[model samples]
Target chain A: MSEAKFSVSFAGPLVTLQDAGRPGNMRYGVAASGPMDRLAFDAAHAALGNPTGGTAIEVSLGGVILNCTSGAVTVAVTGGDFVVEHGGQKRASWTVLAVSEGERLTIRAGRAGSWAYLAFAGDIVAQPWLGSHATHAPAGFGGGAVLSGHSIEVKNTALREDRLGDIPQPEFIPDGPIRVVTGPQDRYFAEGAVERFLSSPYAVTDAFDRMGMRLDGPELDLKAALSIPSEPIARGSVQVSGDGVPTVLLSDHQTTGGYPKIATVISCDIDRLAQLRAKDKLRFAAVSPEQAVATCRSYLETKQAYLDQISIARGTLEQRLMRENLISGWSEGDERAAT
Target chain B: MPGHAPKFDAIADHAVLVSFADTISDEAHAQVIALDQALAKNPPQGFVEAVPALVNLLVSFDVMATDHAVVIMHLKALLDALEVNSVSGHEREVLVCYDTELGPDLDAVASATGLSVDAVINAHLSGDYRVLMYGFAPGYAYLSGVANEIQVPRKTKPVRDVPAGSVIIAGPQCLVTTLTMPTGWSIIGQSPTRILTGDPDAPFLFDVGDKVTFSRINRATYERMKDGTHHV
Candidate 1:
């Protein structure tokens, strides 16, 4: 409790806090409300040695200016590229930073991507309702948008860390076809619609958000897309609504829907899509559920290997690069040197 | 009684969808629930998620490292091994106050079915209802098995916002609203009995096979219950 501090500023579209999410409450009509980018959320916390269940500032594409009041803590920024500043100096993301009391930390928008995570070293300051601090926007559980001038209490846990490894750049990420399986109401559409759906190269439209990802591609021709009563849909579920637009359900999606879901994106690929901003081109490949499971395990294994390499590189260059921005040779700037 | 195997195919790279039938039916629903129960009891490898729908179960497993073709085969084997004949005998009875004031649509419901309000109440109260499933809202149960006399069509234009605890009836079924939601169901009476609560130990008071019942209560009881001075 003594380690917890209040927020001094919220510069962007910030929310209370979130983690992997609130699950098992779906039976009670309560959606599992948690963070948008589950993979990044876990990765950030893992890098900080924080529990996966710990609370973190889930910032939207719009960045924020967060200032803590007390206790020395370790913090990490993951998900989307965001410019972070510590004590008015340019800081870094995807890596951990140890901060003292009363320091101002700012995270501003950078290149591409939608969401970002600011994970504290300890438990967040808030009463847990239904076992999570992550906001369920629709349910109105955790309050929305961390606006400027609003202050939130954050408790610091015992964190002992001098420096974390190097934060990897964007391209270091892997790219692959998003896998899918046919949906329950999939038969309601015309014969070829499902085929076209599996083969078509759909672009993630600008209409993407935490609630749903609207895809743009071939217009599905359904002989009879009867309106059925709204039923349950899970995250990563690709539901083709009445208007023929395919929307991939995400974290903030409703508990149930009436649309005809032709396919469901694989769980492993969802994080990849979550990192993708609007207009990102991606193709869908249909595979069996067993195949999806197999592929995801391999993909996770591949991702783990890359992360391991990144970790090794960071450890080897800990003092020279990651810890201190040390530049040995090159006595002058490139422009000046060329002159 | 046709003993048949449900068709299953990959819905995504990581999820395999097991369909009991082309359309939702009692037999299909039974098969799905039984298979879902079996899977929950013995889940697959890299098995990250499972969601049961009306006539199908969407199972997501780790596909990259594991073999999906094999996993689907295993699921088909498990399905072949299950018995789909029984309508699960489990029951959960929920208490609700049914009256005109609490149920605004009681008059319309009775009128639509050409029955008296008391008859409507008797029909609703005397029968056994199956808990169709939990969705729409937290702990809200979409129960089936209403008598022919209590059936009514949903409002052409649903309400913009229906408060929680609203007992609704539409199309030969009854649905309890656990949260404030917009619905097309005919609003009858409101109940103080919370079908949905946030206790993990008592996660859900009603499972899919449970039954729900309604009891009549006066305005005094409603007010007292609303004020936390009474319980159903």
Candidate 2:
């Protein structure tokens, strides 16, 4: 068996390994958590010829440097347009590369987005808690956070790892209105508050992370019978805290909440919300269930199109951009030039 | 042009909330329970979970597998089979400890109700509270029908984390916490019984309709139960 291992040469703020996520455990009060950017995570895996569901390194607002041992291993790097280096040489973001054993790979500060993914040819190595490899940043992870000097391990898989050239990045990562569905508690807010919520624009705040995105904008006046029982919160549900600052819960949100949920961001659009950086403005548009389903279908089709491709070339944006392909504009390249 | 009123309003893409009125009354609650039983006896394809709240019944399903029309058909059929007041709910008996150390809010409850500490405990013990449903925490059940003397309004401010197995009363209801929870209820006691554990090996202690009662225990009993030396 060919031996492979990785150790962090430089440690950044917050980095962890994540798979698709642990589903079917929400009944146990545990949240289904995985990569914040599913499209990027999938791209990295597709490039490495690794299974889509294996755990991979999720490098976020912070970054890291790593080195592998033994034979040359194929690695796929995707997510934010960060500066990446293989063996002291700078390379384009997104795409797979074969690094010789004992060579160091460096990831610098993120320029376009918040997080990135690094998928090795082999399965991501981590303790699977609750049937997932994703790290729960809020609830100090069961497996330790990625640290310097820790030896990485991977599972034995038979798929051949393939290297791909960069694909051309696309234009217009959409910043169009983030659509939401009027909720069970829409009446809790005043008529004007509801209108303001629909009419006004909210900007994603800097104090954002995997846990939640704090949106800053109008003070929505919500005055109802002083009591509302806390209910189970869903991902992308817009919950207004006491201060009226609307925060959107993400992958790391708590199982339940008491705050009035004025609206729920459809599952497909949530990926768009996740890609937004702090200070990026977004409009809220209410869409019917039909529209939500249509959006979801479009995204699924796009993902299938990319996965169907067998061979990829290096240094073009399409190789990375096409692979990610989240609809409603959640991609990093689109976010940068979005008007 | 819009079609004539198609019966119930759409609550969401894949779920519906049939409402008889805006508030909870005996008739409305009975109606809710009837719908719950009918749905349980025969659920629609892709039916996920059904929760009956004070005045409404919330039905959820996966839209990917089941469309809105089929779910609506199931809900309408459930209402049709619904015989009012035909359903019966089972009760849970939760064993609890009532003492100064375990019952931190005992004195406060006694003072608010103008009853002695022991009197408050006795009244609480005598009342048979029905388990409304499980929520607020993983297996934590919200129960209705606490004695009037034990009932108290929740605090203006909520605490961060109430311990696991906390037996507390808030308003007309009391709750047996199944997980470590943040609550505003008056703590009257704790239970030697653990109703919930996330691990896969253990059997689930309480269901939706099990009776729960309180039993006072000393430090020795608490230790025995804590260390697994005590068996149910």
Candidate 3:
């Protein structure tokens, strides 16, 4: 089979292969361990014109260095702020580049964000456990983490001509307090506790991982018992432990939990939450389910618009920006009409 | 037991939590299973998957295709027409070795229950358990109906590196460890049955509504059976 191979010159802790993740397996006690930033992961694949659900090397804050050893393949790096260098020259994050044999790509932690993604234009050569290449490190499933000295292979590589050119980098805007839908177990919390949770600011603690993010904030007192009958846990569930500390569940969270959840963060904000590093301060705001749905739709539409703009824009980066402005204007009008 | 009216609450924009009752019971479990089966047979437009738990079912959908309001509305219609028939679940027999060599907490559990070690083993074997849910870890099946005589609280501090196939109990629930991890439950025995096969098509041996019973096995049999099948 035709394939391209690369050796992992170096890799940081928690770096593993991730795709769209293994969904529909939570009932069997498996967590969907996709990239923490879904939008960025999709963007990388979009740049390479790779089909959705292609596996990408998820890099943590510790960073990763890869050397292409054989054949040629197109690669794109996206998600969170990170410094990327290709061959002997510096390359911009979120840009597509072609890699041939004997070339090296290095990525390191930048000023912000905790995770980055390096996606290939071909299918990653790995044995998929439970129909996914995504690794659930906590459970030691899906082939484990990619460490230094490991070699990766990709087959069915896409031609470089089919990939998109450099696109305009969108400015990151900090959305206000993360939005949440007050809970499936909200009754377990006292009224005052709910108020305190919404009003107070919480700092992301050092005890953060793919499973959950522990926040140091007001201790949310519960009206009911600390532990309830184990129930299926959703991503972004803000569950209070016996110590009164609140932990926001992430993509790699367990399928079920015994702790009562006070609220669930809206899907649109999960990527923003995932990017937050230690000592990052944030607040929670409760919104109606309908409003949350509207926010999710808006976020998705914006993402799609971005992908559409880049794929069609040809000539230069400035030309892409000019076309992107026009598309945004049209989308704004479309949104108004729909409303 | 009196039947509980199901309550539907929006957990997120893409998910709805349907609670059959405030507490765990056979009636609630039946309702949860019934709804789960119904959804699987005829899923709504954007239905992704339904996860059945002890007394609740979590219905997740694709946000772009459908929202929580529409999904919940469909679920309500399904619930209204749903006939709470007794779900015929698969009955499984699990073999366990109750020797203290594999069961580190066997003596402690017997003392905590104020029963002889043999009586404790008998109490565990006599349990008519049901698979309540799978959680805490991959393929860690939480079985309900732990006998009251042998019921005990979870350990205050969790023990580290509990091995797979460990049959553990705590507060009316029992579980077969599917992975080597930390746990707060009391390990009363070890099972040779392979519950988690790691197969994509059929990974778990027990579904949420399956019935389970325990049988005693010798250490030699446990060793023989363990090597023949995949553990996790």
Candidate 4:
């Protein structure tokens, strides 16, 4: 095990250690507390060519800063538009960097995303609870949240052979209605409740956390009882409480709940929903389960395409930029000359 | 009689929820346990996990390998082959202290139930209970079969910071708190025994369908057990 270490100079309140999460343990009431933005987490790992299931520091909107204290390791940052400064140099969100001893890396909340991930080239050296390093702070299961002054260690650090280069910013579908699969409990709602839910725009409330996101919208009237017999809930389940408010359960949600869930946000859309900050207004669009599955497959394909496109540059940044066409009506030479 | 035929609904693209009954009942609980055990014994391809609740079983699968229809098909076959009668769970004994200091709601529950404080405790002790499911928080087991006489509705407002090891009851359910959190249930007693040991291999003391019975202990014994000086 290589003895690479990074000491936390600053960390956001919600920053915590996470991997793919501890699945199959929900029956014990433990929610699989993985990354809020799973696609970004995977991207960070893919950028470093590290195997999946390794730990990543899940940074919330508050941001975090770290300093390399010992050894050397390669790190990748992905997710939300976060300003990343590595060793006094500004780096893009989806970029990989190598850090040596005494070098400082700072990440602050940027204009776009709410969650980001910092993944190391090697395995993080935190003790795993219940076969996972994902922290469920409410349950106090994993290792709890990462804090300032904490030294994070990575083992088996190996540098990539090819020098890293510029990465194209990933494109997402323009913000539209978030797709959802209506019902496991849509029957509980009044006849027009689902239609109203789909039609009305809901503002993301400040009462958001890893557990669930509360939305302020038209009250969904239930035809059935307010609370059903408690049942197992999925990550994207939109459970409506007695007050007729809908709250979308997230990664850290309890395994089961008593509220009647009207619909479940499709897996592919969960990452998108997780990125929305408080007061962001969004609508829900109903899709069939088959369509949801198909969308998920296509989403995975897109992510794979992004991973495949990541390659080390053979030339300098300017040369690499000049090699590709940058303008719609002009040649690369003209764009370079203008720059 | 056997429970109603299970109804499968797609909760997510990767998850299917099989409802055994419309409301909570022994038959539904049995069916849930039966299905849970059957799936554990022989999980199908792309099987992720099966979470059993009061009257339903939620089966999540890997979307890359299987979708809701495939999972529902697999679960239907598993259900057809399941031996419901074969489902049986282990029994566990919990030691609890029912002192007024530890159980702040004891007197209130007693008055509400039109019974003496000692009678309320006795009723709680006399009841037969089975682990219904785990939910709300880690290792928080919801046990069924709180005595009808002592059963009461959940508090309209939740009391925050209810400590771990609290023996609480609401409606027909009883739960031994595993974490300090807000609870709407009435705290009837406090258990010294650790329900959540924090061990990865076996973090929880009780499992769904486990038969749990409580034994009364004095304040001294509770203190001793809490301090690790008492073995029983």
lDDT of 3: 0.84
Candidate 1, B1-232: lDDT as tens digits: 2545667666556556676666557777677678777777777776755656666666655555445566787687777677666446465555567667777788888888888888888888876687766665456677778787677778998886788788888876787776688888888777777765445467466766566666767778877886772211
Better of 3 and 4 by lDDT: 4
DockQ of 2: 0.19
Task: Tell me candidate 2's fraction of native contacts, as a decimal between 0 and 1.
Answer: 0.06
* Cα-based lDDT for every prediction: 0.68, 0.67, 0.84, 0.85
Global fold similarity of model 1 (TM-score): 0.83
Better structure of 3 and 4 per DockQ: 3
Q: Give the winner by TM-score.
A: 3
Q: Provide the TM-score of the second chain in candidate 1.
A: 0.87
- Chain A TM-score vs. truth, each candidate: 0.83, 0.85, 0.89, 0.89
TM-score of each: 0.83, 0.77, 0.92, 0.91
Which ten contiguous residues of candidate 1 chain A have the minimum total lDDT? A329-338
Which parts of model 4 are misplaced by more than 4 Å? A159-165, A172-175, A308-339, B229-232
lDDT comparing candidate 2 with the true structure: 0.67
Q: What is the total number of backbone clashes in candidate 3?
A: 0
Question: Cα deviation in Å at residue A283, candidate 3?
Answer: 1.9
How far residue A283's Cα lies from its native spot in candidate 1, in Å, is 4.0
Q: What tens digits encode model 2's per-residue C-alpha lDDT throughout B157-194?
A: 77767777778898878877655557778888877676
Listed per model in order, the count of residue pairs whose N, CA or C atoms clash below 3 Å is 43, 27, 0, 0
| Regions more than 4 Å wrong, model 3 | A159-165, A170-174, A224-227, A312-339
lDDT of 3 at A200: 99
At residue A115, candidate 3 shows an lDDT of 85
Candidate 1 residue lDDT tens string, A1-339: 447565657655435477567765553456676777776777676666565567887887667876667677777888777777886668556767766778888776777667888887777666565666767665556434466887766565655443354455334244767777676667678888988887788888878766788989988865563856455577788888767878888886765656777878877778778777778888887776657666666656655543443333233344545444655422332222122
lDDT digits (tens) for residues B150-220 of candidate 3: 99999999999999899999988999988898999998889888788656577788998899999999999
